[model samples]
Target: MQEQANLNRRNFIRISALTGGGLVLGFNYFLTSCSTSQDGGQVIELNAFVKIDTKGRVTIMSPNPEVGQGVKTSLPMLVAEELDVDWKEIKIEQAGLDTVNYKRQVAGGSGSVRESWESFRKVGATARQMLISAAAAAWGVPAAECATENGHVVYKGKKKTYGELVEQAAKLPVPENVAVKPATAFRIIGQRTRNVDNHAIVTGQYKYGIDTKREGMLYATIIRPPAFGMTLESLDDAEAKRSPGVQQVLRFDNKIAVLGRSTWEVMQAAKKVKPQWKEDGTLESTADYTEKLHGILAKKPEDKPRRQDGNIGQAFAKAAKVIELAFDAPFLAHNTMEPMNFFAHVTADGAELYGPIQTPERARGRIAELLKLPEEKISVMMTRMGGGFGRRLMTDFVEEAAMVSRLAGNVPVNVIWSREDDMTGGFYRPMCSYRYKAALNGNNELVAWHHHSAGVSGGGASPDSFPAGAVPNFQVDAHTYKSPVTTAPWRGPTHNYIAFSEQSFLDEIARQAGKDPVALRLELLEQARANPVGKVNYEPDRFAAVIKKAAEIGGWGKSKGENIFQGFAAHFSFASYVAQVAEVEKQADGKLKLKKIYCVVDCGTVVNPSGAETQVEGSIIDGIGHAMYAELTLTNGRPDQSNFHNYRMIRMREAPAVEIHFIQSSVAPTGLGEPCLPPAGAALANAVFAASGVRLLDQPFIKSGLFA
Candidate 1:
């Protein structure tokens, strides 16, 4: 199936002739062949991304959804760079969901730039070479002598704008293998490029999923089960249907929805509807879950060993000192600024969905399955998301919208989840617990390391996490506890919690050994570099480089006046290494203040320096906010926190100054979206320890009562 899809994507490129003698290049991933004229003559296959018009304007299609990660601008920058066009001459348009052509249009995992770096550059280079070939033929000069610069091809002293040569270029066959410019030749990839949609976003002209509209679209709000593991037994929607502007009230297997002309009307009507849910009484509260976790740990469930080395029993038996600790992290809500919402128009013939989805292909597939329709009949369009952070990866909301539209007499429907609905909705980061034990010899040399983690089946630390291969005797065991609360991947997934637990515990070991935390980590990295045991997933040199660079940038070990202290941490995730040093101070009111953060990353080959830095800063702030305040507790199987008022985020006043540095390397770039986040929580926790002398064994430090 995939091979067929690939072939279809390559067989054709849709090219539309502009009214003013220009070309518009569009791609349909499902097209099996090129469309020909009625005369049965071969049509020109303009299978390239670059488009040129009579006015010399260049338009590039950004193939991925932009969730404020700057992908819309950065991806187009790749094409503009290889096309050798001036930045001012380019315009960007968001491409619709095209799995076959785009080949992974999803925006999660921070893999956008990593996956597109070479492919997008080739797109531009192919077009540039074709245009150069056309210009050289017209000038009667060798193609090798013709060079492209600033949207024009130059041969000796004669030059022609790409617009003047595009018609001829469209007729020329695309090169099978085009040579893209080297990193040194990059003029836009590593430069500071402004976001293409900044003006629209700032001026409120940009259309998000919630802003989507159609001629006769009705608004909908679903009334879901009040508690986890509950079923909708009955619902009374008579009041809802009687409300002003309420069009209809429909009931599904698990939800009752109110449809109305306006969002306000639907929301008001939904509030009047009451749903009775049936609970099994087996669902446990957060406190009960914590107790169960402890019980599971105490019973020492059969070891699902992920990694094992030398015998840990002997090492610990002979050790002079053994330190053990437990860490806990509660379930977390994504709380995307734009709540879950989607616009769908389902008809007897086909279905159309539009929203801020990170995985449009997955949504399309699920919707097709639900509707019992062919995949080709369903269209999923992506809108700029307010924020994703892994929440948009799920297609539940999209499917709900399609279902609502189908039940509303095939009329277009916009399903919008209120802030409260979004918070209470399932699909949270799984609550987890980690138990760690370390053994040290008389010389205080690290000897044995044992780690056991338990969480919702799919979420937890990777077996090959840092220090895994650095220790002489290392073993990792994992267990899972099933829960009714639905769980999915959070920003960094398991790394977010694991980093805090592992790094903070390493700091504890450093204290026990009377060694500086940074120096201790450096020592372990040096050991891994010298004689690594087992398979080391990260580059020891790259890991150590960021740590050293962050230390230097942060002025580590330097006095920062009274009551101010710094803490350091480093981790590897998503094929990138990041190290952070956080400076913290205690306020007069006893609250913690994060003054500054210094971060160094080595994700290899920076795509856009400005965008990369912005992502790192944003990740750090998100990490700090979640670490300090974000928590979703449960009571009677329902989420306790409803909105930002209780589930606090990092306010502007609480945001710290972040300084980021990227290592210069020629290797292929990796993901930056998630790597920086893992270490931020650990760095902040370590810094808080330095300032308050309090160890945080759990997340959302506000609950620790140390600040109070």
Candidate 2:
């Protein structure tokens, strides 16, 4: 019933005239359809998303959180484009959590532009139509005679600004249906535009969640258990409380918190308090886990079949040659730059929380339940995030802050996690192992393929990955091992490891068949396009488009000045297709050096070309960094690496030169955040093989001894 009410409210728009003659147009989530103002009634909803002042300044609310993905700027560009207003005259405002007015306020899945493209444009076009109608009616002319251009209604030789017509426009009824501009008529979109918050970001004026400040706010640091599945047996905070600047030390369910007047004092005092914990002894060491994974793969366990087609046993029996290989990837941490921090002020009536959360609505509900308060009384505000990737999707940090505040006499408290705390935290990407087997006929034609993956619980391979529909007899099976460590989505999720294994295996298959890598993929794509097996999720033609474009632009087979070798790989994810080619060279000290990378993407209509390009570039660099050096090992069920010094990142000197190209099409836009990341690790591995005769079957290629 509540869902129906929200859906019904989305159909109508309300225009309220302010005392200064300003016009505020927004979605109406309450009140009846009548426009008449009643006695002392609040006709306008508080969730006004758009406002046009008498000075001709337009303000558009950004409904989603800005986690350095450029949604704050790109979303408003969509509104300004259809509103027929100059981008310079518009201001962007970050919106608070209001599910009734704004729908799906999220930043993950890269769906910001793809999902909100049509609805935001409709809102802008409707406002423009109402203003034009008012101008035409005042001039005693038909509405069709007046058209909006740049912020004015022009008919014949006379023109009036939108400010002049807003007063009368607010009194007019909204049109049911308004015409939106076509793709060809787009002027502000598809153009390179700077970020709206770039100046504030570079000037150190942008306020991130970690930079949030409030009156009488206290700082807190948590001392968590050393290992997974551990229980706090005893905590000694007598010395911690007596330390300088320390106010109090509180014990929670699984951790102890030290609250103080300053962050440094809390951090310093937190280390002095010693906590003893008892482990459940359910977690295995890293070496034991690796051996257990191999054992699981060797045994014929009960198969959880994801996809199966044709007779795989018969095809393998008739094969002339067969190839089998196994691959593994370690657990990974998000390690966001800002760490995890949230401010909470819980009162007797309600609770207020502020932080850089990816899902504000979900957080609000969870906090409300935790505080034992009504959902309507709780509020969650989103702040700019230093980085989210996929860490902010979890609300554990938010819940901790609220719990701390509630336990501390409902005083405002801000909980902050240090770099070490975040690194040793739970919710890392699950470790995975993949085993693959392939058979070929006498004519060197692929006949059958089998894939089986084993991983920690909640991690599995994509059944619809490449070679699924391309092979005659294909099957994918999965097995899971239960453990106490928590795991969640990290960027591309399962596709990240799946692409590395599948693409690299394809390159090896091409070499064994005495065929070019790119040619072999194209042939398989052609086969899938000609006679696709059961429901193929990807468009074969679009998949082949990026492959051909990348090869053409990258000069696939061309020489790259001596010692430089190139490699190519492609994959499709998040409804977008991307292909990448990497170039590498061997250094004198027996080390591999990345030179350059060429990429081709087909994500449908480009909203902001500049921002899209940055996403692709960043993904490539991030993928390379993880493939080269990022890995989290375990000892006694605890993370071995803590800070950046041990879990190194790729520096600027090690970053490769990147060149990107996008396919031109009129289709709807898809996400760019994760689609370009899957193939980068495989592409770099393939390039290393070309430069030096080594086949890397595992990740963290630097430790695989390719250079040694």
Model 2 per-residue lDDT at 328: 90
Q: lDDT of all predictions, in order shown? A: 0.83, 0.83
Once fitted onto the true fold, the runs of candidate 2 whose alpha carbons sit more than 4 angstroms away are: 1-10, 13-20, 27-48
Candidate 2 per-residue lDDT over residues 1-708, each given as its tens digit: 132222223466454543545566663223112121222222233453567766576777787989888999898888788889988878888878887777678888988888877767767777788789989988999888888888999999779898888777778877765667899999898989899999998999988888877898899988988877788989888999999999989998788989989899999999899888898767566777788788888977476578888877899898899988899988889988899999999999999899999988889999888888998999888998988888889899999899999888888999999999999975788888889889889988888888888887565678898777888898888877787777878888788778888998899888888889999999888878897776588889999999999999999999877777888899988889999999888777767788888999999999999999999999999988898888888887888999999987888888889999999988888989888888999999999888876888887887876643
lDDT of 1 by residue, 44-97 (tens): 333324556655678777878788889898888887898899997787777777
- Cand. 1 Cα-lDDT: 0.83
Backbone clashes in model 2: 0
The residue pairs that clash in candidate 2, if any, are none
